[model samples]
Target: IISPDSVRLENGTSLCSGRLEVKSNQSTQTWSSVCQQDFDQQDAEVVCRELGCGAPSVLQGVLYGDVEPPMRTTEFQCGGHESALLDCRSSGSDRTTCSPGKPVGLTCSEPVRLVGGASRCAGTLEVKHNGEWRPVVYSDWTLKTSAAACRELDCGSAVSVGEREESSYRSVWRIRSDCVESGSALRECAAPDFSFSSSSSFLNLTCSGKPSPCWDNLQL
Candidate 1:
């Protein structure tokens, strides 16, 4: 999911978690890592937002394999709300050296939400896109599938994963267990189809306590 944003994460288990890489504005087009010292929470926020993900959960250096530079010499100064990382201000001068293996490795949380419930952990599941939160309809989903959502929400183990019958049909996102099992963020998982239907059910979860590693180890 390399976007036109000229910033990307590499050497990660998935697109949502990886080593930070930025494309050079040079005519020939090169990609380089950013010094961890040069990037911050504000920069991390913009990177996550630009990539259509939740907030930055982890930022560590050398978590991704140590790669040497051809790195960006300038420091990024993001205001914390830019649409793209490149949209931020850069230092006028070049940094001569960065410590070895000090480039950033970042992990962004999944863009999943729970609404209309008693707590942040319990509610109808929704995935975000463009700006609006879209409810999802998942016929093939299970507790295994909801487990990932719990992890994303920082909720405990998925106590119950079920559906509630709604009175009317409306447009909602469609999610599949296979795609979610592949472990992509709900929005990043392929196109979670959006359409109006009489499915009459919206996916729901009641998450409580702490999450279980068992959910992570289950087979689909």
Candidate 2:
């Protein structure tokens, strides 16, 4: 008899829930007998122990009553231009990487990409460093820059720019902007073409542009 939480793949193989442990092939079992089994919490632990699968640390606190499993930060890499986010770390190591197509290591308190610019495997990104949310300044900000920001922010596309809120008379090159994130900062989007303003120590950014994709040299 198997637990209800068990997963039965299309191949007729069943993987019990507790530890994602593989069980005897479903085809080897009689349907009549298998259907009669029941599943419960105790069975969960048994399944995991049998399969040699360790409990997932992320769920240990909520599921197994282990209140302080461990603290960790995740990371991601996208757009193919720059580096990875801040939190992506290895299971047992303090080191982390955001290689091509991976995510960077950004903390929860830090803003990450939400909607657009995750093309080319890596690109520019933003994070709340110090006390202000600032854009990662590359050698220069271009159309690709805006697109990456918009996609990461999940704000559809870049629109326009005017003047900084701190100084409406300042030049566009002198202002920074704020980006609202959707999920990951690796989606595709355009750069901001407008001006942004800020009263606090935050940088001013209000750029608007098209929603076209950046040129991926490898794809074309």
Candidate number achieving the greatest TM-score relative to the actual structure: 1
lDDT of all predictions, in order shown? 0.76, 0.26
**Top candidate by lDDT:** 1
RMSD of 2: 20.5
- Our model 1 lands, by Cα RMSD against the true structure, at 5.9
Model 2 regions lying over 4 Å from their true place = 1-127, 131-140, 162-220
What global local distance difference test value does model 1 have? Answer: 0.76
CA error at residue 81 for candidate 1, angstroms: 2.3
lDDT (Cα, tens digit) per residue for candidate 2, span 113-168? 22222442123243432223334322234444455455544445554311222323
> What is candidate 1's CA lDDT for residue 58?
81
- Writing each residue's lDDT as its tens digit, candidate 1 over 1-220 gives 3355587889786667799888876676877888888988889889988887777878788887888764655799999989999889988676767888889888877677888898878888888766667787758888888787676567867889888888656657777777777776666664555566665688888888454233222110
